[model samples]
Target: MNIKITGSGSYIPNRIVANADFAQHVFLDEKGAPLTYSNEVVADKFRQITGIDERRYVESDLVTSDIAFFAAQRAIEDANIDPETLDYIIFAHNFGNVKAGAIQGDLVPSLAARVKHSLRIKNPKCVAYDILFGCPGWLEGVIQAQSYIKSGMAKRCLVIGAETLSRVVDPHDRDSMIYSDGAGASIIEGTDDEGGILAHETASYTYDEAYLLFFGNSYNKDHDEDIRYIKMYGRKIYEFALNRVPQAMKECLETSGIDIKDVTKILIHQANEKMDEAIVNRFYKLHDMVTPERVMPMSIHKLGNSSVATIPTLYDLMLKGQLDDQVLTKGDIVLFASVGAGMNINAIVYKI
Candidate 1:
């Protein structure tokens, strides 16, 4: 049995936040006093390091499920499938919808359930749930959907990755510059054709590296107060991705019996442009070859990193020819890879 991604859609917030926007808010020192740093300096440094000029943030009233609902509706329309026919709604997100004016995150209904509700899906048989796999959540959801289709248990599945990182990020922290809000969705269905997901690989290194990137939900000695925000050791994560991601991609390609040269595109997570480029370069080096310049498409410059939504959003943009000089055709081989907060890494090979 084969599973094919029949349709795809993505939604990014309308508000565009430039690097200079950070200057308006004041960051506090340990003494609860303002730490002075010019917005120009901060913005220049951010652009130099992350290659992000701007990113989008949802309106104050919007939640994770809200963006996901928009994306899912577009995907279902694209797939030309009835909402009632969907067997599963697999939503992936690290933080569920954070209510307006609320500091803490909430997931009482689960993002998947909320999306189903908003879609007005009345079929009780359509199971809905959520997956928390850091940035790999979206790919992991697809992998699970593949299992259901292969087992003859499901005919169609809606896999969505959505996040409002702006809600979870600490505006006082520099890491917040790399976070954004968006959602992407795909409709996967059982297919007799051979063109679809061919192979996949996933791994976790949660022992020591688990602390490398974490949410601060406790008192911070450095700040002399309680803090709950996304925190990360940038150097550690950069080193981890440079070392681990390429190997994971190579393993998936080898397992699928596909040659590196035959891959049409490499749609990696839009975390960092430089890191993603290096990972692809390193993957090709493993096969004693040079990386192709046009193979990897990127949107990090405009979208930043929306956690699990990165890859799916990029995939959808490419599918619709919204990306520069990129297009997919029948029988094209593509690779998808991501590494993030879980210290989790995943890769997948698919035929378009």
Candidate 2:
């Protein structure tokens, strides 16, 4: 028996925030001092490094769960499956739903349960839960779904990755530019088909890397120090990801018995254009080859980094033929990877 992604969908918010949008904002350094350069110089430098021109944000009327439900609905419709038949719904996210103008996360009911409720799935057997694995959350949910299907705990599952980061960002921090809001979902089920998820790998470095990404006080010291928002050591995290992620991908690919040349698409987490490129290049170098053309599809230029939503969101867009020059055909081997908070890393070798 095999587990496969039978359907996929994504929710891209309507609001477009371009790089020029930050021109008048005050960007501060760690010491609470304003940057010496103008916001234009800073934004331009950021563009060159991250390849982000614009990003999406959920309107004030919506929250994370709303978009998660939106993506889930489309995925269900695409799969053409009865909601009541689902055996599980796994939601992956770091920060839960945060209301507009609010600093706290609302998780009284888990996001997965919230989505399951919103989905109107009345089957009590549909075990719903949430996983906080940073940017890899979505892929990790897929891995969990694969395990459930393989272990006979489930036959059909829905895995969703969604976030509304615009509400939680520190407007004063330059790193906030890397965040956006979006959601992506997939329907996974047991199949008799020939190709599916082949192998997966996961790693956690908690000793030295634990604090690479964390929630910290606003960069503007005047802002309440007790109030924290998503934060990271960008350079340190970049260096760490470049060194670790490729090795995990290579190990997963080898475990699948799939040659590096067979990987036609690499739907990596859309973190940063430069970091992702360096990681992919290193992966190929490990195989004694070079990175292949069009093997890597990216959405960061416009979508920015929606944390756990990146990989699944990229997959949904590609499968729908929305991504220029990218498409997935039957029997194509694909690789998915991500590294983020928790200082976590993961990769999956899959056949589509």
Candidate 3:
């Protein structure tokens, strides 16, 4: 039997934050000194590199679990499956529910449990849990669900990736412009039909790259050291991903036994526009061919980077015919890949 993603859903928050919104804000360097460039110059340079004109944010009353539930509810409906039949509910996220103005993440009960509770799934057989594998968390959750199906432990599963990064960003750090809130979910199950997941690969580069992306005190320096926000060495991460993600994708496609020519689409993590272009360009170079036109679909131009939610949200939008000129038909072979905070990378080859 093949493992297939039967249905999918995503929640892109309604609050749109444009690049121009940062005009009056103070952006500081790590040394607590102000950047020499004016706010317009800083935001413009950021757009040139990251290609983010705006991003979404959750309303003041919402949290990560709230959005996760919204996405899960839609996935269940899309699959037209009864919630009680689900054998597992796997949720992926970095920071848990960080309330408005809160400095801490609330993770007493797993986000999976909270979502299952919100979905009102009454079956006692449904096991729920959460995974923290950085930006690749949702794809990693899909990999885990495949394991359960292959091991006879589960036949149907709900995998979700969601985050409310707006609550965890440092206003003084320019990198804060790259994060936003969103959620995406899928229903995966064992199937006798043709299309399904074919192969997957993962890697961890923890020697020195572990701190490439980490939590740190605000750039303002006046913020308490005990109170930290998401921080990263942007240059280091771009270099690390360039050197690793493309190779990982090649190995995964090879393991699936699909020729490079048969691959139809590439759904990569939406971290930066320039970085993704470089990685895809390098992947084609490795295969000794030029990149194909319209093979990759992107949401970062408007949605920014929602970590684990990027790929799923992009896929959802594609299926709904929201992305112009990007389409996937039956028998299409697609590659799903991401690189993020563990300094981690993962890729999967799937037949649609």
Candidate 4:
């Protein structure tokens, strides 16, 4: 019983803030660099690094659901599925449209309303809600949806990763450069076709490492001030990556009963160029696996790090220009891997 991803879509804003333009808005240091030096260098090295050349952000008055609704509409159309058939609408987010309110916490309900309203989904009466867990949130949603569909709980599910990281990023920090606002949706439908989420495995190491990657000391002193904002011990997280990710990948491949050499493409979390290189190089050394040539280049040059959106967005990009060809033959394997701030690493095997 393989659940297949019938359609996948992403929502990017029309705004294209060039690196040069971003330089104008941000302050510079004595060395003629952005106050956080790394972002400055990233901007100088890559044209799209400083600002999303095509990023999406809702107006201050709008909500996350609004952005999600647009993306959901496209995804449903791409899937060629009627909205009336949707059984569940799972909204995933870490940050939302409105701040915590007295009545209903964040904007999850609004997200549901907007999606249903935009698509005019009726009859099956989709239930909507939010799920969040660091950057790995969407991957978890995929697994949950896969289970639900396989269990007969849903015939089709709209799984969304909607985030407004800009809300929490400390305007003063360099680390905040990695977080961005965007949404990605995958239409997972129950089918006899054998190409959905085949296998998934996660490994977590509880640590105060979260402290290294977050901020907000004055506002949330009671909680780890780090949790309130994005905080990262750059070198330390890199070290953790090199140590743990390979093992997780190895286990994922073994559990799927597929050799690494058999994988046609390895879709890694868009954490950073260095992390992807380390994992790709390690796997290549062990098993001659070719990281899909097209997606690898896009990771560094085209899309900066899009957090959870990276794997799915990259997968969508790779699927184009090739779906018509015979390169991705039946029985081929696609590997999806991601690591998040909770000191957790995950890898899922997809048989295409």
Q: CA lDDT, every prediction?
A: 0.89, 0.93, 0.93, 0.64
Better of 3 and 4 by TM-score: 3
> After superposition, which runs of candidate 1 have C-alpha atoms over 4 Å from their true positions?
27-37, 217-227
lDDT of 1 by residue, 1-352 (tens): 6789999999989999988788786555434455576767777877877899999999998999999999999999999999999999999999788876677788988889999999999999999999989999999999999989888889999999999998877666666889999999999998788789999999999888888888774223354245477888888999998999999999999999998889999999988777788889999999999888789888989889999999999999989999888878889999999998879999999999
lDDT order, best first, reads: 3, 2, 1, 4
lDDT of 4 by residue, 1-352 (tens): 6687788777664544344444434533323345545555655644433333323344555456766777787778889998888888877665556442211236635565667767776664687767655666677778878888888888898888776565565444444555555667888877788676667888666765555455443222233433455556777887877777877877778888876666776777777766677877776655665554543333423344556666665555555442223233467688777777677678888876
Q: What is the per-residue lDDT of model 2 for residues 1-352, given as tens digits with 9 covering 90 to 100?
A: 8889999999999999999999989999989999999999999999999999999999999999999999999999999999999999999998888999886899869999999999888999999999998889999999999998989889999999999988888999999999999999999999899899999999999999999999988989889877888889999999999999999999999899998888889989999999999999999999899898888899999999999888888998988889888888889899999999988999999899
lDDT agreement of model 3 with the native = 0.93
lDDT of 2 at 189: 97
Residue 208 in candidate 1 has what lDDT? 82
Alpha carbon lDDT of residue 250, candidate 4? 78
Q: What is residue 90's positional error in candidate 2, in angstroms?
A: 0.5
Off by over 4 Å in 2: none
Positional deviation of residue 82's Cα in model 1 after best superposition, in angstroms: 0.7
Write candidate 3's Cα lDDT for 182-294 as tens digits.
99999999999898999999999899998888999999988898998999999999989999999999999999999999999999999999999999999989999999998
Task: Indicate the residue-level lDDT of 228 in model 4.
Answer: 52
TM match of model 1 to true structure: 0.94
Where is model 4 more than 4 Å wrong at Cα? 25-42, 45-62, 98-105, 108-110, 123-125, 215-228, 286-297, 322-331
